[model samples]
Target: MLDGIPPLLTALASGADASIPDLAREVPEEEWPRLLEIVRRHGLTPLLGEAVLPHGDTCPPTVQDALRTHRDYAMLWHRIQMNDLALILEALGGASIPHLLMKGTALGFMVYRHPWLRLVGDTDLLVPADRVEEAHELALGLGFKVTEEWADAHHLPALQRESNPPIELHHQSLYVPTPEPGYTLVPVDFSLLDAEAGTVDAGGFEARVPSARDALLQLSCNFGSHMEESIARPLRWVRDYAELLGRGRVRWSEVEERIDFIAPDLRTTVLMSLALARPFIGDSYEPALLEAIDGLPNPYARLTRVVSPRDMVHEWTTSPRRAWHVLSCLMGPWRATKWSLNKLLVSREHITRQTGLSGDALCMRVYPIAFALHAIYHLRRADRSRGE
Candidate 1:
C-alpha cells in the first residue's frame, strides 16, 4: 500500500475534516514529525492545527509554518486559476464558439459552492470536431494563439497568449487514437449551443459554464479515462462529488444510468473518489456503484494513489507513454500493436510538418535522432521489465 502521506498531511494541517487515525496508521512514528513539519511549512496549520490532536496534544512551530504556507499557496493558485478561466471564457465568448466547459472549472461553477476550492490550473473547452478549426481561428482572432501543437490531429492544440491564460481546445471528449477499432469517445450527442448556458460572476466578467449533468459526465471521464496514481485530482473530484451530492440537484439514479450508457466502466472513477474521500464523505456511496467499482483490475486500482496535480494532468494532457498505456489496456494485444505502428507513422508526419525534414533526410536528421531517444527511453524500460 502506498503511504497516504500527502492526504494525511493535508488533513492534519489544512482544516480538512476527515478521519486521520486510519490514515495516520499508515505512517510510521519516526516519519510523523517530518510529515507534520512539511504540512506546517506548507500553510496547512489552520486545518491541521489543534483540532487534529486527540487530547491536549501540541503541534511544533515548524508544522504551524508549513500549514500557513500551504494555505497561502492554495489561495494564490486559486486566484491565478480563476483569472485564467475568466480570460479564456472572455476570449471564447468573444469568438462566438459555443463551447462546453469541462472538468475542474465546470465542477467549480456547477457544484463547488466556492470556485476557489475547485483549483483549476488551466481551462479545458470542448468544441465539436467540425468546429475545431473555427474555434482555433476564433481564439487566434481573440489574441489566443497556439503555443504548442501536438502531432496528432486527434489531440487538441494548446493555446495561450501574452496576457491571457492557457486553454486546451479538445475536439473530442476521449482521445482514443485511430486504427484502434472501438467506439469513439466523443462528447454527449446533445447540442451545447442549445443547452442552458449559465453565467458565473467572477468579480469581473461572467464565465459561461455547461449544464450540471454534462459537467458531472466530464468529471467522470476525467477521472476514469486517465491513469490515477495521483491523489490531488481525485481529491478535487471527491470534493466536487460531495458538494454535488449535498446539493441534491442531480438525481443519483439518473447519474448512474448515464454512467452505464456513456461510460460503463466509470466505476473506477467513483471508487478512486470513494477510497480517498471516504474520510471526508464516509462510505455513504450507493451500494451498486461500490460493488461494481471493486471489480476493476489492479492497474485501475493504482490510479487512486496518484496525488500530484502536475503528474495527473500530464497523464491526460501530453504524456505519450500514458496515452499508449491506456490504449494497450483498453484494446488488447493485437489491436494495440496496430495502434502503436500508426502512432509512429503519425509522429513522423508531425515531425515533418513541424520541421521541413522528410524520408531519408528525416531519418538522418536531428529531429529523428531526438524522436529515437524518446522512443528508446519509453521502450527500453519495457524491454528490461520483460527480461526481468
Candidate 2:
C-alpha cells in the first residue's frame, strides 16, 4: 500500500496534468487496483482521475472504466444522501427538533466541491441533550427505526429508514472515551458552536453547519474521539481537514479562543490531526498553527506518523484481527492498557449485545483467554517490526 504513495500523494497534492498511462507504468499491474482502492477510500477517486486525465496515464481500458464507474456511484450516493438529508431536515423542522446537520453533509456542500463528490453513509443530526428523546420520537414518527443507543456517548441513538439514509441524532458531536490524558464521560457540548452556525439550503431543505472555525475545531474533536475509540480514522478525514484549511474563512484567532473557552484539551487534537494530514493533503495550515503542531511533544502527537491509519467499522462484529491491529498500533503500554480496560469493563455490554453472553464468571473467563492471545499477537508484531 505504501509503495503506491508517490502517485497517490501526487494526485492529491498536485494540480499538474499528468498522463495516466505514465503513472500506470510506474506501478506494476498487480498494484494498480490496490492504488485505485486507496484513493477511492480516501474520497479522491474523481479528483485523482481529474488530476491524471490531462497527463493521460495509460491505464488499461478496464481499470479506467472501473474507476469511472466507482466515481459515478460515489457521486450518486452523495446525491442520495443529500436527498435524504433534505427529507430529514424537513421532518425535524416540522417537529421543531432544533437540529443541525453534521460532518459529511455540511462539508460536502459547503467546504468541498460545488457538487460534493464524496459518499455519505448516514446523515448526522445534532440535537440538544435535553431534546434527544423528542428528536428520537420524531425520527420514529417519520418511520425511522431506532437501531442502537449509547447512553454513555452523547448521541441519543441511531435511527434508520429504508427511504432515506440513517439519521444519527446526536446530543454530543464529540466523544472522548479514554482517560489517558483526562476522563470526561459527558462528550463535549456542541451547543456552544450553535450560535456561530449559519444555514444553507440542502436541496430545498434549510439546514445549518458550524462556521469554519467551529467546523475545524469540531472535526478535530471528532477525529480525536475516533482515535480514542481505537477506530482507524479514515483518510477522508485527512481530505476534509485539507479542504477546511484551504477555505479562507477560517479565523485562527476565533478558533483558538473557542478552544480556550469550550475544550482546551482539543488543542492537541487539532494539532495532531493537522500534522498527520499534511503529508497526504499538502500543507495549507497557518504558520503559527504549523509551528504549534511542530512543537507538540512527541509519543502522542507522533502516533499518526507511527501508525497506519484506516477507517474500519467499530462494532461487536469486528474481527479479532482488528483488535490485534489496534492493540499493536501506537506506542505500546497506554493503548494496550486502555484496550484491556475497554475489553473488560466497557465492552461487556457490547459483547452481550452481539453474542448474548452474560454472567460475571463466564465473561471473566473469556477475558483471560482473549487478553493472553491479544498480548501474544502484539508481541509477535513487535518482533516482526523489529525484524527479531
- The candidate maximizing TM-score is 2
What overall lDDT, based on C-alpha atoms, would model 1 receive against the true structure?
Answer: 0.51
**What residue runs in model 2 are displaced by over 4 Å at the alpha carbon?**
1-4, 13-30, 49-58, 114-116, 149-152, 180-191, 228-233, 247-251, 302-305, 308-346, 349-388
Model 2, residue 143: distance off in Å is 0.8
Count the clashes in each prediction. 29, 11
Residue by residue across 1-388, what tens digits does model 1's lDDT show? 1144356644532223555545655655567676664433322333343344442223444544544555455456556656655666676677676666666766656664455444454567777677778777766776677765552343467676663345787776542222343224654443643365576666476666665654665665565543311122343454566666534666456666656675565545555544445444444456655565566566555543443332332233234545445545555444544444333424657777887886656655633344344555534422321101
Q: Report lDDT per candidate.
A: 0.51, 0.59
User: What is the C-alpha lDDT profile of model 2 across 94-178, one tens digit per residue?
Assistant: 7776777787667776776544454555677888778888877866876778754433355666676664456677787754334
Question: Can you tell me which runs of candidate 1 are displaced by over 4 Å?
Answer: 1-59, 128-130, 151-155, 163-165, 174-183, 190-197, 228-234, 245-251, 259-282, 291-388
lDDT of 1 at 291: 63
Cα lDDT over the full model 2: 0.59
Clashes of 1: 29
